[model samples]
Target: MSRIPQLVIANGTVVNSFGRRHAHIVVVDGKISQLVDATEPVPDAERTIDATGQLVIPGGVDGHCHVAQVTGRFRTLDDYRTTSTAALWGGTTTIIDFGIPRDARETPLEAVLSKKALAQESRCDVALHGSVVRWDETVPWQLEQLAAEGVRSVKMYTTNRGTTMADGDTILKVMREMVRLDGLTYIHAEHDPIIADCTAQHADDGRIGIEHLHRTRPELAEETSVKETLAMAQYTKAPVYFVHQSTPGAVDLVTEARARGQEAYSETCPHYLTLDDTVYGSAFPEWYACCPPMRSPETVAALKQRLAGGAIHTVASDHSCYDLTQKRERTDDVRAMPHGLPGVETRMPVTFTAMAEAGSSVEDFVEVFAAGPARINALPGKGSVAEGFDADLVLFDPSVQRTVDGGALHMGTDFSPFDGRTLAGWPAVVVSAGRVVLDREGFHDPGAVGRFVSRNGFREHLAATADLSAATL
Candidate 1:
């Protein structure tokens, strides 16, 4: 029989889906078995982590990331190994990244399997969200297959090269199919016609500054796309997730849609909450460029207010890093740069600082970073430190302060948009699935053992449906 490794983390404040509390956690067989008062004697175990004066919170679930995925004309730097390593160092234990199918030849299953092969050596748990590139008669069947393979979510773009830009009918069809399969459909909401026209107009006038990218893809573009997407969701009663919602106006739409009992939700990124369009005027404007480009300070303030007031469901990094050479190539016309920035490693610290500054409780942070993401993705036994849950935990030091340097970070990228900024509150220790992966000094000697979780609960529903379909035939 395999030995059940016993360990006790004592005198730490535990923060879970419920709230923060002072308790001692007992770990056995790589799972949390009990949480009791700190005054109790520390159980004899293989090891004891003395967490006095520290906060122990559930490890983050990064719901949106672009690890090893490629955008048009550019490829990402961090692959599965490097990206998950970086995430562990930053206190995230699980990631839900996009498995985008090749527009030319590959099927969704092939793409997802290929990515899984690449991620087999990861250091943190992983799951994939399939991106729908081609919407045809076979697309619904493909989605069902993906769900069977443990991918419970599918992504569709309203505007992207080589991806399907479905009309209202196609969108409705996809929504209905996804709903019937009991899978979540994530949409990249943006008006393609408006963006194309604005880009052409700016190209003609030679007004392609980094600042102008926002004007080209204005709030109206997002607003209109969100309206149309919600309409389709309403028509089909499909659960829709709006990715990287940036503006206050867009938040209002999502708020209203949720109120109407529609399963419409939105996610915002760290870049939108911190950086704004003015950053584009800096000496290295390309460093701040990203899709759904940064907006005004007013919008940022409104987003903060909305997030604090519980309007926003979750926050993600949306991290996509390219080499510095790729970013600098578009120095002349900011539109030429690859649209993304590095944040997977910085997301936790930055958000923690922001929440502290806003006087928001730690419970609120746990909801957005842990519970909400895991629940939305239907990840079982994750997002908490209760009994029988995986021991994915982070020991945080609220007093420690540090400065962010893009060049010094572990990401494969060569730059960071938040370089030189000091942030309070940092993760002192990170544990994933009962193994200690990172500490204050950096990564430890534990070998990479992360595995792809075949989601059991929600994904099982898809398999059951497939069986029923065959039986009916």
Candidate 2:
């Protein structure tokens, strides 16, 4: 019998959501076989990495991102190859992107299969949250099948109108069905009426500037939708996660619901936590245009405080990369401009630098960015440094500092939202499944060995408290 291949990462401060200690991680067949003390002499088979003064933590799990997604007329700039490479360079070993149907004619299963085909060349692990575009009697069965196939979550929109938004009753029905199927719901919560009314007023007044984009979709719009969805989630007994929460009020709602022992978790992105609406007044405001626009600085500050206090559960990138040419063409009308920013490469460093400056520790970083997201997304073998977990790790050097430059990044976009910002704590080495994908020289594409993770399903803690009586009437 051939001996199992082994690799050891030695002399690093292994950190997790709970704590950190000096340990040597042993990897056998791409799985963590042991976490021994650094002082102990271990038998190493293949290779060893010297992580003398670095912090070793679980690789990032970006639970919300858009790569190769087709939106209206234009497709996203980054596909699996570029997006996954950027993810690895940024210490993200796993990403959960949306699998959206191209049109009404396509079934959810077909959408998922197409997305998986696109992800076949990914340089890092990729999973998908199937989008439910066509809701009918057959929808529940499809959702259950998708869940069983490792797509444990589905995304629903409430503001895109004829494109992807589902009505209130439709959402409620879907939530109820999700409850029965053991599938989780990820919602882009924004009241369509509010946004539409505001947009109509702006158009009537000929105020279609980027500033109007912020005015049309104010914090109240998000708050109203968030509160309403929480109620539906509470009544339907389904676990709902709000994505890209930008307002303090919405975060408060999630916190309050959890206080009531409800099943809810709020996810905020790096852009929302750090950037303010002030960017709308910049020379090129179209570049910063995204749905649920950045909130007031005061709200941003409050969100940071809440994040530190554990009110905010997870921080994701929501990375939707669009080229500068795409954004520039619609500069005359903000509504026509593509929404999103290239963030997969900058997500971890930017957020890490901000929270670290706010006095957050390494453990807090792991909890929110890695472990918490992994747990929420149902990736059992991710987000921790321990035996029996995947050897997906990052060796971070906190002393190194670098300024952000979009042109220098590996992302497909030409500009960075974080340009000129200096950040520390960059991952000097990113190891995915025991293979080194990023090192001192640069990123290396280790072929397409990334696997689709079949998630273990929702956290039973919330399911145990679900109100089954709230099922569809």
Best by the lDDT measure: 2
Model 2 Cα shift for residue 3 (angstroms): 3.5
What would the per-residue lDDT of candidate 2 be over residues 377-467, giving only the tens digit for each residue? 8776788887778999999888789899889998898898888889987889999998988888887789888888887668652342132
Candidates' C-alpha lDDT:
0.81, 0.85
Error of 1 at 127 (Å): 0.4
Report the lDDT of model 1 for residue 121: 77
lDDT of 1 by residue, 42-107 (tens): 666687888999999988999998888766677888888888888887888998888887665777
The top-ranked prediction according to TM-score is 2
* Candidate 2 lDDT for residue 189: 94
lDDT of 1: 0.81
The reply for model 2, stretches above 4 Å from the true place, is 1-5, 460-473
Error of 1 at 27 (Å): 1.7
- What local lDDT score does residue 81 receive in model 1, on the 0 to 100 scale? 80
Residue pairs in collision within model 2: none
